[model samples]
Target: MAWWAWLLVQSVVWCSAGVVAVLWWLWVTKPHVDIPGPPTLPIIGNALDFLEHPVTVNKIRDFHRQYGDLLRFYAGPKLVVLAAHPDDIQHVMVTSKIVERDPLTTSAMRSFVGDGLLTLNGSRWKTHRKLINPTFHSELHGNFLEAFHEGSLYLSELLATDSAGGAAPADVHAAAFSSAMRSFCIASIGVDPDRLIPDISKHEVSAVMRRIIVLMQTMMVRPWRRSLSLLRLSSEGRAILMYYAHLRKSVDEVIALRSAATEEGPAKMRRRLLETLVKPGGQTAIPLSEVQDELMTMAVTATDTTAMLMSYTLALLALHPDWQDAARRELKDVFGEGGDYLRSPSLAELASLRVLESIIKETLRLFPVVPMLPRILTEDIRLSGGRVLVPKGTILYVAPFLTHRLPQFFPDPLKFDPSRFLEGRSGEEHPCSYLPFGLGSRNCVGSQYARLEIKVFLATVLRRFRFLPHSRWEDLENSVLSITLHTFKPIEVYCVPLQESGL
Candidate 1:
């Protein structure tokens, strides 16, 4: 053979040998776990499952049914374990070493939210959490209560206007988002959204946010586009960056206005969360960029989650009038009957809303805003009493949605029963079984604020309007899992004035 032909043959042989050697190394080094899962395709593994099915919640539930409590699947070479058992979930959440969020899931989030509380990990997360914790104290809730009440009143007015005084169905989710965003703005930054951003409407900002979240979720399923550098190369990635820039600009403008106001005097800073956050002199002073990130985090995380909770709660209540009446009676008892229904409930009065709280809990159990919590295991952990081992470097998904539906944890989990959460009935449930806000030390920091905001809105709105069933309720089961859970269609409800409904 000629010299060139011999060289070509040698190169082909060497390349084939290298590929075989790498494959052998990967096979030998792969972590071993005694877990059963669905059959996977080589290289791609089970990624086609997500790509083929748009509804992730349903697909995850199907996997749970097929593989039992602890199931494993590969997301394009990444080993992902879905832990539905409470003990396993608790172990994963409480372990200090396992505090890091899954890089694949959070990479897109970081671009949108920066390194805020939701995406931060390690000592930086700890420091930020420590600084932000005091802002949500019970005492400060009173300040937030005013914003909540105002937002709720605005929500009622919007619903009333949209429903044509009970003649038409109203978009509950849109109204809830508006209300939640308003309350978040006032409480977090001490400014009304309308006044702060005069040119852009809240609806426009919401649309931008929704688009950004959908793009981020798209990046999550396609592992190839997981990193920012790789994502920027695609059209979707560029769109996310553009949308996020708009969002960040709006938030920064609000922060700048709030910061300027804070500079005026200490008196002006009262009851403002931004004031507390922006002020210097802590043991570890936070940078301005960190403040902007935290505020943006609050805007993205708090508003939508609370709005979804409110929408789901109202939808469920509309379907079950008896529960609605029961909730109203509780509200009547606290605020007194035939009085001003629009009046804001005090901190003590808000706390007195047990029936409303139960309804909220049940709604969350049924439709958790954040259905799946993703983490990456740093060390080898044995679960199920050491009978099963999940090796280090594996991706872990502590699915509250799956855990909440487990027959062992919640009886007849599909049923919408608010009474299941009333005091004594919930005593038998595991601590980690019902984590609507999440579990462990790294759980949502604004959980208390969210609960309080929802209660205030529900109390105000339920008092003014009686929710009736709408045609859109049939689409409730069709939810899309983005950064947060969202109904495939807008959740609509018939709003009848309390007097007209003869309540």
Candidate 2:
């Protein structure tokens, strides 16, 4: 109604618009280091590109090619620096003491893995590293071999039966593979893997395994897409929580079994960790619950991972019969057709056969069971190339995917050539390269156990039946959940009996 009132209102509106304009300029000029990249969007960043091919390893490789070694990429709203050089990776691993596995990851993975070594950090982690290091000592290798032998033999028998019956092929359950491998590891610590499984039958176990795998699959699919109406509902979100409950209950049972077992036989002997867990500070007082959680952790991380890897390796071998044939021939030459190189072969005897070891190395290169290592920086740290300054809270990721396939390191990187690992050489011609199980202090502690399990499974199966893929190479594709790279199909193959070698 009045001229003065109208002018006052107009002044307020103009001030608000001016503030918004200045904020936009600051947002537009946010510094991004020049490492090549395909165009990135304003707010969402590379979230869509990541979800587009999270299951396949190719997406990560493309980032390496387009962005160069130390490029910046965003997942959801978080900025992550992907490291390509081993030196830069080790720098990140060693320099920052406070880096941790992503908090959201630990919370979600605790759905299945629990608070195992895979997720633990800082002082607790150091205590764990100090305690378990001795378990893998050279002398103790014999004690672990018995469990590895028995479990591997059981796996061997399983494949043999499938070959004999000529049943429809199997999809290779991720949890079952993980659980079974962990059973072997658990048994070495005096707990039976199967008995630890709560009286469940093979059929029931497989069903439970499938459920857990599906829960993780759902997480990957619904990732940044959780804003969608369906996923936001009470029913869909509630289902994920239920899966976690069952997983926790099952792991808790196994942990109890490990806790109850006493120190009598070699299997029952507790390493340094047991002393800290069961008998703290020479008091001889046992905190049985931590022991239980530690046992669960090992099982949760170790079992599914090794199984996924073995499954992937088998699928890859089926796809490439030439390598499969070569591996089989090598096995026959050394073990003399089902002679059990696994049970009684001395380290010297095993080492004499260089070819067998080479194949294992190559399998690791192509299908590194765990493709990515994720950490959050606690402090600002400089990498080898001054261009990359890793700041606190920046989630750092190092992928075996890019390093394993780099053309500079391994010639014609995608091709499966076992000879590249001949004579204990780096599969990659590139230095600080080829980290299938990672390196330095933070390397996969179960590397030895994984190698033994995979070798035994491959050796025994190939001896019995030659696996030939049913579909074309193009049909083979990987479907990943969390960390493991795996096939979505049954990995169908014909198991032709070897006439000369009696298996």
TM per candidate comes to 0.88, 0.78
User: Each model's RMSD to truth, in Å?
Assistant: 3.6, 5.8
Off by over 4 Å in 1: 1-28, 95-97, 198-208, 226-243, 259-264, 267-271, 280-284, 426-428, 471-474, 500-502
Top candidate by lDDT: 1
- lDDT of each residue in 1-503, candidate 1, tens digit only: 99999999999999999987775566555666788898877655676777663455776778889989899987755788889888888788865447788887777688668888888878899998887887787767878898898899899998998889889988777778878878887887777677644344445544555566666777777645555665478775565566567667877776666555534354542445676776432211488788878888887787788877887888899999999999998988887764464566888888888899999998898888888888888888998767987888898888887888877777888888888888645434777788888876777888899999999999988888989978344477677766788776677788988762226
- Model 1 residue 212 lDDT? 60
What is the lDDT of every predicted structure here? 0.77, 0.59
Candidate 2 off by > 4 Å: 1-32, 50-55, 94-99, 163-167, 172-179, 182-186, 198-247, 254-289, 337-347, 424-428, 475-477, 499-503
- Residue pairs with clashing backbones, model 1: none
Window of ten residues with lowest summed lDDT in model 2: 278-287
How many angstroms is residue 374 displaced in model 1 relative to the true structure, after the best TM-score fit? 1.3
Model 1 compared with the native: what TM-score?
Answer: 0.88
